[model samples]
Target chain A: MTLTPKGEARREALLDAVLRVLERDGASGVTHRSVAAEAGVPVASATYYFATLDDLFVSALRRATQQQVALFADLGEHDLRGFAEVMHDWAFTHRGAAIAQYELMFLAMRRDALRADAEAWYGALEHAIDPERLHPVRTRVTAHAIDGLLLRMLWLGEPSTVGEIEAAVREITSAISA
Target chain B: MTLTPKGEARREALLDAVLRVLERDGASGVTHRSVAAEAGVPVASATYYFATLDDLFVSALRRATQQQVALFADLGEHDLRGFAEVMHDWAFTHRGAAIAQYELMFLAMRRDALRADAEAWYGALEHAIDPERLHPVRTRVTAHAIDGLLLRMLWLGEPSTVGEIEAAVREITSAISA
Candidate 1:
């Protein structure tokens, strides 16, 4: 059923709550009650909006991925240094969201329904890198390399300096160019 | 306290059980009771072996990282292609352990005590890649890139082909050599 504007806003709020919970407590902390508590809504509201806990997670994941894709879509406008700075800031400042994204990725490994979203997220990264500048395989490889670096930074709880990230971006770009 | 031979064996068994539970269930599934059950030991045994759940997780993560470092330390013996093949196979066959490692990494992000282990894990990887051949920064960058690539493969639940991994490894090696 189509939600009224108010209902739509509430739904969005609930989804945001799911992400907050995921980031704060990881996947296991995300239950119907926990999400509802995080959202400041009644537990019934979560069940009403998303029939299953999986549905809530999937919906939140889709929204988060879309926002990220949109953010990356604009990266081409920035030079390598500028792009690296943006990435460095984005990851460190948005640590919670970044960690939550990885949590969803692990969840995708076990749940078939979440696989497409994960692929699309990676596809967005590949596209943002502007694969046209490189060989097809190199483009894919570069994207994966960047992915791994960000993940490592997150996992280690160590944010790379802008200079370090710039050097990495330049290295990958140069490799693809070569 | 130094343990007798049997006590050491029991401790090892408990740690293995932690990994098993971590692999089968995500980090959240790991609890005192669950680990004890996995070890086929009494609940008291788990509590006796590790004073707290956090202690158990920390000990298990250390063991896992050491084992990984040992595995990577031998990579020099293999040619690039051989190394790539092994990586491809490892990611696919040990998918559970791979994911569990990532899960632990996220846990490390939250828990202060676990951060050093995570840092050392990356340090071992950087050492394995051998920075002497590359500029110190380049070596660090290269290590992070490979990490990103491996993590992407695991996150997407798509095993890279041997050719794909080999190409990526060669590119990184060549870039460092240059």
Candidate 2:
């Protein structure tokens, strides 16, 4: 569907609002009313953007994927050195994204459309990481390893010491060491 | 609640049913009525066995914990080595369970009581793998890394190869080997 510039901007705002809703309140927060409220538009405007719940879900998921990809993209054209700092940021802020993503994952398991969105998200993630420089074997190994670490920290949120943080950095560096 | 042998056996059957429900239908499947249907018992039997939803959640989680522990108990109690085969089993047969556990983790995020239950589950997991072996730096690092690997595999399904699997196994073995 073609959109006027204003409509495009509003759509971006709506997608951002949906991400915030999903990030904050999770799956329960994604109703049409809530999206309208979050995006500063009337409830009717939500329909203008997303024709159905499936459309809304797919749009929100696309926004989440783009946001996550930008997160890694912001790390710039650097080597895998960017991983540790990104993880540290996740330990601080993007914490809830892990849960939202996990829940989406289970949802994806049973739904082919959602699974396609998820796979697209993962593909974007894989692309942003630039896996060629590191050994493909080690790159994939450490990729899952780092993903797991981020997930566990998000789940438990155990208090971390300076030393513990440094050690986690060292361990990741060593695992996929260039 | 006190129980005759028949009642005790029925309760045991009910808990087994809760686990089966979780494995099949995930967290939403644990309601008193749904679980009763799965167990082939009267709905009243659920209220008889589990007084409250919280009690039911804890019992179901604890039962999951026990089965997992018992499954590993046969590994003869080493560090990372003991879990290798079990991890492989999960990497295959119970991929769905792994996905569900991660989804259950998201559900826990919304509830403090359930989060506490999650902490308890992690406590059992941590107990199985000796912290001392992870050394001063690697303790939490190792835990998080393993978690990331498992979830990534569950998400990707069969995309990973034996070489990549061995790379993960090698990293864990090397960590505790330290």
Tell me, by DockQ, which candidate is best. 1
- Where in model 2 is the C-alpha error above 4 Å? A1-14, A36-54, A76-85, A112-132, A159-166, A175-178, B1-15, B28-32, B42-58, B77-85, B110-143, B159-168, B171-178
lDDT by residue for model 1 over B56-168, one digit each (tens)?
87888888887877777677642677678667866877878878877777766777777777777777777767635445656666676678778767766555788877877
lDDT scores for all predictions?
Answer: 0.77, 0.65
Clashing pairs in 1: A148-B148
C-alpha RMSD values across all candidates: 2.7, 4.5
Q: Model 2 Cα displacement at A38 (Å)?
A: 4.0
Candidate 1 regions exceeding 4 Å error are A1-6, A131-134, A157-159, A175-178, B131-134, B171-178
lDDT of 2 at B13: 92
Q: Which candidate should be chosen as best, given TM-score against the real structure?
A: 1
User: Candidate 1's error at B19, in angstroms?
Assistant: 0.9
Candidate 2 scores an fnat of 0.38
